[model samples]
Target: MLILGIETSCDETAAAVVADGRTILSEVTLSQDLHNLYGGVVPELASREHTRTLVPVVREAISEAEISYDDLEGIAVTNGPGLVGALLVGLSFAKALSYSLNKPLVGINHLEAHIFSVLLERPELVPPFLCLIISGGHSNLYLVESLGRYRSIGSTRDDAAGEAFDKVAKLLGLGYPGGPAIDEVAKSGNRDFIKFPKARMKSGGYDFSFSGLKTAVAIYVSKLNEKELQKRRADIAASFQEAVVGALLDNTIAAAEEHRMARIAVCGGVASNSRLRERLKASSETQGLLVFYPSLELCTDNAAMVAAAGNFRLENFPPDDLELDAFPYLELGD
Candidate 1:
C-alpha cells in the first residue's frame, strides 16, 4: 500500500510517502528554528508554523515520491500526545485530503510511531522485545509483544530524560535542544568527575524519576562561581549525561531481562544521543542480547514512522471517520 503520512506533533512539520510500511519513497520535514530563541518549543508558534509549512512539505514529499494524491492508498497522521494545536494542523489537513481523495485515514499514536520507527530500517527485526522511547516530551519503556500489541513496563514520574537534559543544559548556559549540546561537550569531559544522583524508585518497579537529578544539577551549578562553572561545565555535562543514561539503561535492561526478551529497540529523539547508543550497544554485547535503533534522522519525529504505523493500523483496524480529533495527552496503552 502507498500511504501519505503527516506529522505535526510538536515543532516539526513533516510529511512522507511510504510504500507497504517499510520503504520510504520520500520524506520532508520543516523544523521551526524559532523555538531555539525561546530555548524550547512555543505551542502557538509551533501550530502557526505548521499551518504555514505543512502544505508545502506534503506537496514536496509527494512530488519527490514521484506520485500524486490520486495515487495514495491511505492517509495517516499523528493525532495525539502532543501539542494539541500543532497536532490539529496536521490532522485537519490529513482529514481533508482523506475526504477529498476518498482514501483510508488512520490516526496514529505519536509514541507508537516512535516504536515502529526502527522497522523502517530494520524490517527484519521481529518484536517480542523491549523498546525505550525517550524524547523531550516522554520517557517510556514497553515490551513489544508484537506489532499493535504493547505492554508498558515503566515511564518517567517527573521530567523526561530529554527534558532534564534541556533544563540542565540551560542551567549550564548551554543552548536549547540540550541533548546534542551536552552529548558533544561531554565527549571531552570526565563522566566520573562528579557524582550525580540517579533516582531509584522506592517501589522498585521498572519506573524512572529524573526530577531529583535535574534539581541536583541545578543546585550544583548554583554553588559555582562563574569561573568555576566555566572550568567545570564540560565535566558537569558529562556527569549529568551519565546519570540520565544510567537511569534509562538500567530500567530498560531490567525490564527486558525480567520479561526474558533478548532483543531491544530504542527510538525517539533522545535515542540519537551518542552515550545512550554507545552504552546500549556495549551492554548488548556483554549481556548476550541485541539492540536496535533507527538511523539518527529517523530517531527524531518524522512522517515516515507515522506512515509505517498507519499502514499497520489501516490493515488491522477500521479507518477513522473525519470526526477524528487530535489528542494532546494520548498514551500508548490507551
Candidate 2:
C-alpha cells in the first residue's frame, strides 16, 4: 500500500511516500534556515515556516515518487509531542488531504516515529527489543514489545541530551544543532580533560537527568579565563560529550540487563552523535546484544520515519477519522 506521511513536529517541514512501510519512494524535508541564526528554534517562526513549506514539500515528495493521490491507500501525520503551532500546520494539512481523498487517516506520535526509524532502515527488525531515544526535546528508554506497543523504561527528568549539547554549544559560541559541532571539535581533545558529573538519580529508576550536567558545564566555563577558555575549547567539548554519552550508555545498558533483553536500538537526533553511536556499538558487542540505529539522515525529524510509523499503525491499530487533532504533549503509551 502507498502511504503518505507528513511531519512538522519541529523546525523541519517534511513529507514522504512509503510503500508497505519498508520502501521509501521519496522523502523531502524543507529545513528552516531562519532558525540557525537564533542558535535555537523559535516556536512562532517554526510554525510559520511549516505553513509556508508544507504544500511545496508534499508536492515535491509525491512528484518525486511519481505517484498520484489516487494511489495512496492512507494519509498519516504527526499529531503531537511537539510545538503546538508547528504540529497544527501539518495536522490541518493532512486532515484536509485525507478528507478530500476519502481515505484513512492515522495520527502518529512523534516519539514513536523515532523508534520506527530503525524499522525503516532494517526491514527485518522486529520488536521485543529495547530502545534508547535521545533527541532535542526528549530522552527516553522504551521496552518495545511490538509495533505500537511500548512501555517507558527510562526518561529524562530535566533537559534532554540534545538540548544539553545545544546549550553547551551556545555557551561556547558554537552554532545551532550543537551535536555535530561539539562532536567535531571533541575529536582533537581529551575526553578526560575535566570530570563532568554523570547524574544518577537516587530513586534508582530508569529515568535520566541532564540539566545538572548542563549547569555544571556552564559553571566550569564561567570560571575559565579568556585564554584558558580559548585553549581548552576542544577539551571542554570532549569532556562534556563524554559525560553525556556515558550517562546514556550506563542507563541503557542497565535497562537492557534489568529487562533481560538481548536486542537494543538507539534513535532520535542525539543518536546521530558519532561518539554515542560508537559507544553504543561497543557496549552492545560486549553485552552480547544486537544494536540497531536508523540511517544518519533518518536520525532527525523527517517524513520517512513518520511514514514508516504510520504504516506500522495502519497494520496494527483500528482506523481513524478525520476528526483526529494535533496534540502538543501526547504521551506514547497513552
Candidate 3:
C-alpha cells in the first residue's frame, strides 16, 4: 500500500510517502528554528510554522514520490502525545486530505511511530524485544510485542535524558539542543575527569531518573570558578555524557537480561548520539544480543516513521473517521 504520513508532533513539520511500510519513497521535514532562540520548543510558534508549511511539505513528498494524490492508498497522521496546537495543525490537515482523497485514515501515536522508525529500515525485525526510546521529552523502555502492541516496562521519573542534556548545556553555556553540543565538546575531554551521580531507584522500580543527575551537574557547576569551568568544559561534557549514557546502558542491559530478550533497539532523538550508540552496541555485543536503531536521519521526529506506522495500522486496523481529533496526551493503545 502507498501511504501518506503527516507528522507535526513538535517543532518539526514533516510529511512522507511510504510503500508497504518498508519502502520510504519520499519524505520532507521542516524544522522550526524559533525554538533555538528560546533554548527549548515554543509550542505556539511551532503550530504557526505547521500551518504555514503543511500543504507545501505534503505536496513535495507526493511529488518526490512521483505519485499523484490519487495513488495513495491511505493517509497516516500523528494524532497525539505532542503539543496540541502543533498536532492539530497536522491532524486537521490530514483529516481534510483523507476525506478528499477518499483514502483510509489512521491516527498514529507519535511515540509509537518512533519505534516503527527503526522497523522501517529493518522490516524483518523480530518482536518481543526491548526498545529504549530517549528523546527531548521522553525516556522509556518498552517491550514491543508486535506492531501496535507495546507494554511500557520503564520510563523517566523526572526530566528525560535529552532534557537533562539541554539543561546541562544551558548551564555550561553550550547552547540549545544540548545533545550535539555536549557530544562535540566531550570528544577531546576525559570521560573520567569528573564523575557524576547516577540515580538508581531505591524502590527497585524499572523507571529511569535523570533529575538527580541534572541536579548533581548543577551543583558541581556552582562550585567551579568561571575560569576553571571554562577551561574544563570539555572534561565536564565528557564526564557528564559518560554518566548519563552509562546509567542508561546499564539499566537497559539489565532489562534485556531480566526479560531474556535477545534483540534491543534504541529510538527517538537521542538515539543519534554517537556515545550512546557506541556504548549500547558495545554492551549488547558483550551480552551476545542484537541491537537495532534507525539511521541518523530517522532518529528525530520524521514523517517517514509516521508513514511506516500508518501503513501497519491501515493494514490491520479499521480506518478512523473524519471525527478523529488531535490527542495531545494520548497514551498508546489506551
lDDT of candidates 1 onward, in order: 0.92, 0.90, 0.90
What ranking of all candidate models by lDDT puts the best one first?
A: 1, 2, 3
What is the total number of backbone clashes in candidate 1?
Answer: 0
Better of 2 and 3 by TM-score: 2
Off by over 4 Å in 2: none
Compared with the true structure, what per-residue lDDT tens digits does model 2 show for residues 1-334?
6899999998999999999988999999888979879999999999998988888999999999999999999888999899999999999999989999998899999999998889888866788999988999999999998777899978899998999999999987789989899999999999999999999899997899989989999999999988988999999999999999999999999999999999888999898899988888888888898988898889889999889889988887876786888888888862
- Write one digit per residue (lDDT tens) for candidate 1, span 143-230: 8888988888899999988899889989988999999999999999899999999899998888889999999999999999999999
How does residue 268 of candidate 2 score in lDDT?
Answer: 91
Q: Candidate 3: give the clashing pairs.
A: none
Best candidate, TM-score-wise? 1
Measured with C-alpha atoms, the lDDT of residue 12 in candidate 1 is 90
Candidate 2: what lDDT?
A: 0.90
Model 2 scores worst on lDDT over the 10 consecutive residues at: 315-324
Question: What TM-score, to 2 decimals, does candidate 1 have?
Answer: 0.98
Candidates' TM-scores? Answer: 0.98, 0.98, 0.97
Tell me how candidate 1 scores on lDDT.
0.92
Q: Any runs in candidate 3 off by more than 4 Å, and if so which?
A: none
TM-score preference between candidates 1 and 2, better one: 1
